[model samples]
Target chain A: MVTETSLSPIATFHSARRGRYEVAHQGVLALGEGTIVVEPGHNFEQGLQGLKGFDRLWLVYLFHLNQTEDAPPVMVKPPRFEHKVGVFATRSPHRPNPIGITPARLLHVAGRMLTVAQADLLDQTPIVDIKPYLPFCDAFPEAAVGWGGLAPTPYRLLWSEGARERVAEIASAHDLRLDHYAEVQLQLDPTDTSRKRIRATEQGFALDFREWSLHYEVRGEAQEVWIEQVTERPEFPGPSSLK
Target chain B: MVTETSLSPIATFHSARRGRYEVAHQGVLALGEGTIVVEPGHNFEQGLQGLKGFDRLWLVYLFHLNQTEDAPPVMVKPPRFEHKVGVFATRSPHRPNPIGITPARLLHVAGRMLTVAQADLLDQTPIVDIKPYLPFCDAFPEAAVGWGGLAPTPYRLLWSEGARERVAEIASAHDLRLDHYAEVQLQLDPTDTSRKRIRATEQGFALDFREWSLHYEVRGEAQEVWIEQVTERPEFPGPSSLK
Candidate 1:
């Protein structure tokens, strides 16, 4: 009947993926690389010895960006599936314990720093533990996955010339990754507005992202999604304005 | 620069493997089954919805039995490998965070309880998180493991009828799993005394287990190990006796 346990970070991950929206759903789908810097003065260097030989490593980290103070929702809608599933059945950060485990390809290890790729982690994410991936134990290619294995038809993402330029502009201006977010949210369930911040408009559909929105439309069999434009949402009066 | 995070257990695992010695190195190699009971009043039942559809699950748990108050050794010698490796390179419980993750075969999920098999967990192990195993993301059978992949010749374990009866007697009397402990410690390195509790005797080799010891011999090419007898150690004046 242990109530609680306290854990400290042994290292910090540095990645270009600065926010949750920028991270890929899976590490193998991540496009770029990241670095892990182990804290000093704890003899962690010795702990890292002989780790460079492994091709992959498992990182145990905290979902530090979880902002909700209340209990997490038991049911969550995963982007890949149509129905809402239990939080345990989905890889959602909002959990009883906001812990995440991801495997990254080991590129090189120098002193207390490790360079890895295909890691779907955010910038400055705290890493609590690291273990070399043992293929015989960790891998199970033939394992069954019920509803998850039967993936729905994925939408082929297509960005118009205007939309691509606008996305890049948003990335530079606000440090927001709308492109990656759109891919993660709209690729599988393009028309599902129940759980997504999407609504039908005169043109087609518009997905909201705080102060901005991305307008898109679904084509034949909803297999192709064309992001036509990105625009700033109209500002409205708030409590601050009233005050 | 986050300092620490507090985490509470969402569930507890019940298993026949009561101690670290009885548990296998990998879940797939474990002998028996276990049950995970999610704590009530947390809406965990809803959290477990749709988890049964998964064939396997990843359990994130704490190594509650790690007794050392001091910092863990940076390097450790794994059983399969001869040389010492980095703590991060092996699945040792003596870690900075003491967190462990293992994938187990899903048997059944009823209400807040989950029945799983081949779980290498101690009795009453606290489970912080559980996630359905997605083969597309979790599996990498072709991944490389450096020194770990080069497994040494394993010793075939053989027990005499007398020894078998003696082991059963000890199990009933002391409730200690000496048999499983011997298999884990001796099967890979039968005579490696550097890291294991093995000592050369007049007749053969003896492995210590508290007040008792198991005597065995390494046969031809060290490919076979024969457990001849299990006997109590000679009584000595311990610190408690002096006190």
Candidate 2:
């Protein structure tokens, strides 16, 4: 066997809060409840300035909450897969190393902080690394979808009695705009092909677009819809939200 | 805080020679070895049948040999770095997962057994998974090389007394050519930029290749290199391997 060598970390990351991370690579990722700020213009600009020109960025973060002693699975039943596929074939949170990567829109960057748009990650997720999205290298214009074929048809959200009110309340409290096409687009099925129907208690309403059962809990008064859970079936067990 | 989900093993890897591996989705990865079969084929073909066309397929195996129960370092000093770079910057085996990917040309496959070209792995390393390399996706026509910068310069090996004779012996025994460019290219850095220097020893020759010190022992009158110890160097106590 060829003898191997070790390595060391160049930077460190500290979680300040949900959606916010502080990376000790000369600057910090000040993620506020809604807006993110990076202090010290120099460091912030150095890390995020070039990102502004890109339409999207790849966020490589640690699944800090998924740490466990159990061995990682080679196959996973994704929330949408409903336990039908192997873990390696699906993008499930459960993996050997919970290294989460998401392609998110680059809204803006101020100093060391970057304000991202359309991010599905929870607040305060530790951001390990970031790279600009190159359309040529990152985007496969004519790529074939594996098992989860073409994108599913768009669906409308039907909120129940108290659902709309709750959405509005949550939006007001968070000081975020709820009624936007971007937000609606986020609800569309980026994966899956066939359409179905599903319902859940946590989420006020369920709509099946393709193979996924999308659960939405709308704070009615707030005019906002929060995705409570996404599963293959309405009867699937809800994920435990520790916080 | 989101509720923590129960950690569970998602998959289990089994091998006759290497220890079994229980992998969970999003779990840490350990290195081991496995065999790969290469079928003759062209890049234009699709599916398993095309895979049989190539005499050798590249194996991107993991370097699970040096894994330990320690937090990974953020930086590492690579042997090519002359022991000065950080771990994250180098491809050192000492990392959080100690995952090493190498491309080994496939030789032949009989049933499930594969005879591959020279590989740097031990006898039985667990093979994680395999995928047919698509030249369109994997190859970069104009990729830039940092630090070491592209392929190394070529060099001719000048074996000491009995070294060439030993090469002949191994060739005849293995029914292969052992004294050609393949062996030399595999043994020495083509660029000859490696700081390692081989010196004649009582047994054969000794060379310090950063993480491991190597010694060559004669194989039936033919000089063959046998691995000695894979230990750390005090003179250049570089960073830990994992990060």
Candidate 3:
């Protein structure tokens, strides 16, 4: 009789730079085009003996970024949807086991380092295992994607040199997305309650960051937010209490 | 920084009986239709929160049958093929990590008990985690299946009353599939050199399976084996030295 056993990750992934999106984009990129390096990997040597023939591999890894008991409540609010959805239904990061699996295109496998066409992992995602994708067994093209079609509306992000520097500085402190932080936020709710920066203008709307203000025209018909200008927010005096 | 961590299976699968096949059949049954009971399953309560919306789920379970590190030699001889294939190529039980992920049809989620339409796990198999099958993102119908099209030749398996009882008794000890074990062995090489069971016969071949002698005729052109009778092997006198 087979008994219970424990498992430890055999390897960890290292990448050149971290991306803005935490999870892999469904419709666009199944796996990102990033070359990841794994180390002290036992699966490298004998485990991948016959993997050279296949062009794709299944990356079985742990969600190391979400390895914690402190998760949001069961009903998680997906970014695209209006109401909160159940945890199991939506592919939310806050899971009980925090295990993540993705299919990556195999570019090259040199020793321990596996260069893949795409990867949806953090800089140092712990890989539990890797298996060659048996296509005949795992193909289901006609399968339905439940609650998975809501793509966030496209919003062009514009930044001034000064605005870029300020956004990067503020984002670094909180370790937030440099590319998508402002862009995604504005697309969802351009009224800009975040940091209390949005203002109604004659043209459209203006969102004021620390020292920068982003001017954008909301095209309701097209469902697009076109950022026109990024200007510096003027300095104001202290509160009236000081007077 | 997210460091290395360990993981233990939360739930264990309990079934009324174990089946013949180890890995999920590709062209045949992707996963067996059975209602499994998972208990005190760490992720049961929270993990299955929104599973009712979808009809299918991806069961990330451990290959509990292959828990021991003391596995057979790396060059595993697959049943269908004559030559030895790499351990990584075939979906054999003897794997480096022994983690099997299968897509199962969710029947009903009553509290903790998730009745699934399909499951390939053995009885008392340890479940590592579960993930919902996001079809849109994971669809790849045109993917090639490398070294995946070897079908076992069809053979007729017949058993007498005594042979049936003996085969069941032996299979019970090892907790294996009696029908599959017999059918697969015969399909691959009816000469029965697999378990060292083949003996020369005037008609065709005689397979000595423990105390049972399975008499069969191999039609080479038809690629079929027809078993005539199953009889108990005669006990000979001890060697001269032992006497």
Pick the DockQ winner: 1
How far does residue B153 in candidate 1 sit from its true spot (Å)?
Answer: 7.1
For model 1, the stretches where C-alpha displacement exceeds 4 angstroms are A149-163, A190-243, B67-70, B80-82, B149-158, B191-196, B199-206, B215-228, B231-243
lDDT of 1: 0.83
A-chain TM-score of every model: 0.77, 0.55, 0.63
Q: TM-score for every candidate vs. truth?
A: 0.84, 0.40, 0.69
Query: What tens digits encode model 3's per-residue C-alpha lDDT throughout B1-243?
Result: 444455565556665335434334432243345554444634446555666656567777776656667544555666546666556556666665677777777777777667775566666777766666766555455545455433445555556566677667766775544444455456556765544556778887876544556677877777767676666667623333110
Who is ahead in TM-score, 2 or 3?
Answer: 3
Which sequence of candidate numbers ranks them by TM-score, best first?
1, 3, 2
Q: After superposition, how far is residue B235 of candidate 3 from its true place, in Å?
A: 7.8
True contacts kept of 1: 0.79
Error of 2 at B208 (Å): 10
lDDT of 1 by residue, B1-243 (tens): 678998889999998677677787777667678999999999998899988778899999998887344688888887656788889988888888889999999999999999998788989899999998888877888888877754345577899999999989988987877888887777666776665468899998998877778899999675899999999878633423211
Q: Please tell me the TM-score of chain B in candidate 2 relative to the true structure's chain B.
A: 0.49
RMSD of 3: 7.1
In the range A87-137, model 2's lDDT, one tens digit per residue, is 333344555545444555566655456666545455446554454443333
DockQ of each: 0.67, 0.03, 0.31
Q: How would you order the candidates by DockQ, starting with the best?
A: 1, 3, 2
- The per-model lDDT (C-alpha) reads 0.83, 0.38, 0.59
* CA lDDT for candidate 3: 0.59
